[model samples]
Target: MMLSGVVSAFEKVLIPVAGRISSNRYLLAMRDSFSTILPFMIVGSFFGIIEWVVIDPTGTVMGPNGMGLGMKMTGLTGEAYLASAFVATLKSLQALCNLVVTIGFGVLSLFLVAAFSYRLGGIWGGDKFSTALTGIGAFLIVTPQQVNKVGGFSLDYFGNKGVLAALLVATVSSWVFVKLTKNKKIRIHMPDTVPPAVAQSFAVLVPVLFTLGGFALFAALLTWFDIPPLNDLIYKVIQAPLMGFSQGMGFSLLYQFIIWLFWWFGIHGHNVTAAIQNTVYMPAQLANQDGTASYIFSNGFFEAGLMHIMGLVIAVFLFSKKESWRAVAKLGAPAMLFNIQEPLAFGLPIVLNPILLVPYILAPLANTFVGWLAVSSGLVPIFRFVVPWTMPLFFCGTIGTGSIMGGLLQVVWLAMDVFIYAPFVIAANRIDDEINEE
Candidate 1:
């Protein structure tokens, strides 16, 4: 539904504008599609940064001494500080804001590091150029201890600007490479009739090659400079994005795999919720609370927990045309409770449904806003307590946010979810009924 609206709006608004610039229908269409995708990429990149840089720095971006600043900031307060309502309120809000900012920063940082590394690799042609590999490396190496040390040494020569020096070197090197290669275009020849497997392989290989080339170029640049070892820079650049992408993809795949596993055993896949909670969710909770580890797990549960479950399931249930209501029932029970529901998703047959894809992406984003509000308003506690993900929804809220009021806010979230999804459900059910009659 959300996606439909976006598409509709884009056709009405963007298409006309694009048509004026390009007389060719194909070019106009491509331009419009690109324009539509740009916003999502930007927004995704922003949230990704938050998750990596701010929320889960320990796990995502931080080095050994990264928490020093946070510790120093919090150390200024004592137990007595918690006693003051004003201070408590401020601290709570600060923590929440910090988490959001960190996650956003982390995601953006990943993109920056990747983009820079790609450019760097292209300049030097140093090693196997793989963007994914180099990006993973950069993420690992940019930790606080390493960054501070590099920055500190650089500062000794360049004043407080040594860190800036590194950033500058990275930026300039990347810009030059992009300028050289940006205009080059390649065309692949595929038979008009191709086997499915061959087509799929080709599809996968294109991106893989691009990534490798990007990484190799970054490696080459490092070797040329002899400033930072190509291997070290590449390693750090690659780690965070690689981990984040893999973790997210792995959890998603695991959820679906568990659903199938349960169905084969004639048991509902709902129990997989507990597994997710124990594994990914619980670790996220622990990391958020760990004194030196807080940044790494910031809002981990919210993104990995509440949003993931709700976003995909809700989108499918609302837009599907098969067993819509039944699917909703299957999903809503565990979703409302444990927040897991892949069985419901498969039943809905929503995987490729165009109309439903919109909300699948947007609804979780809407939930993010709600979570942010709860934190900012002090209605929910900022992340403080480390609890299991399978903990009841209310408890998860209370402990994750660190306030009783936060627990109470979960009720509001429940209400919001129902409200947002109900219309879509009704629409889906009507569609399903019509299809059945046909």
Candidate 2:
């Protein structure tokens, strides 16, 4: 009873805090704006399959070890019939991936800026299209574009590395634009004869001018002071510290707890934490592709594969006549195998069902901590590759770490979650029984 009381008290305290955070406009904008990065990354992960499975030398891939269909085609790479065609295909695929990365990770600023401004436009009754354009202009205006001697501008200033600057520039600039343009006097009134499009464009003119001019002056100030560009300055002063803190073991529990807690409340935990993920973990995941990464908590570390073996686990052992559980297990089986958990998340109904909440929230954290300790103790190889979360368990882990033991580790965590959730499942069944009896 006391333990239950303590939990109730904890929830009472936690709910209000989570509510405020989930409702905050700034954080919401950040979360929603950054949400698309994952999809972009997911698309890019398919490209990863091509490079690692097709182009890589035979027997080089760690996990999926049958014949690579892509590698087999390499025989066509000889000059006999047309090696040029094979090479062209490979180059084309690579170029597609390169553009995805360049746009998705490199100039992610555009999405964030556009989303934030679009959102602000709705909130402040301004023109959404104009606000979006102004936000993009403001971000570009404040950013110190670095041009090489060859007349090429480096895209680094616009990529994931520039996220913080993008957030600041977009959020503040859009707010400024919306706030000023909202005034009736600041907008240019067009006669009924004028086209609606021209009138709307004219309406945003003053706010766009002031907002962009402010950024231009800020850039000039940095230029005069001879400091690094805005992105570099913000990265050094703001993002660098957060990145260091997030990559540490000390922050793992707190981070995972906040994320899962959000999940328990029916929120997309990843969305709420998107800003941090891009600034901290995503960078490490990108670095791991080069095979020199030392981080344990890269992209695939907290993947759905970490929980993949759970559906079969419950279907086979945990329940006996619980039709709902059985149905969810069967329904979620296909998706879970791919490490996509929406079926399990909603079908099993982990959200807001207090009976399953304990294990639902704690399981991922337990897996993460254990994975960290395993890597630290050298019990398993550290993951130095970004395995797409959509990959199945043993494969995701092994491919991620390039070690069979890592695959086994994922299985082990699945078993551990089964054990953790068993008692809760029984308790929930008993509660259901009581209600049914009544």
By summed lDDT, the worst window of 10 consecutive residues in model 2 runs over 55-64
Winner by TM-score: 2
Scored by CA lDDT, what does every candidate get?
0.43, 0.67
lDDT of 1 by residue, 368-413 (tens): 5666565556555556665433445666666556566666766566
Which parts of model 1 are misplaced by more than 4 Å? Answer: 1-297, 304-341, 386-392, 435-438
Task: State the lDDT at 61 in candidate 2.
Answer: 41
Model 2 Cα lDDT, one tens digit per residue, 238-316: 5566876866877877778887877666555664565566667777777776766677777667663356337334633
Best by lDDT: 2
Worst 10 residues of 1 by lDDT: 153-162
Provide the RMSD of all predictions against the true structure, rounded to 1 decimal: 17.2, 4.9
200 in model 1: Cα distance from truth in Å? 23
TM-score of 2: 0.75
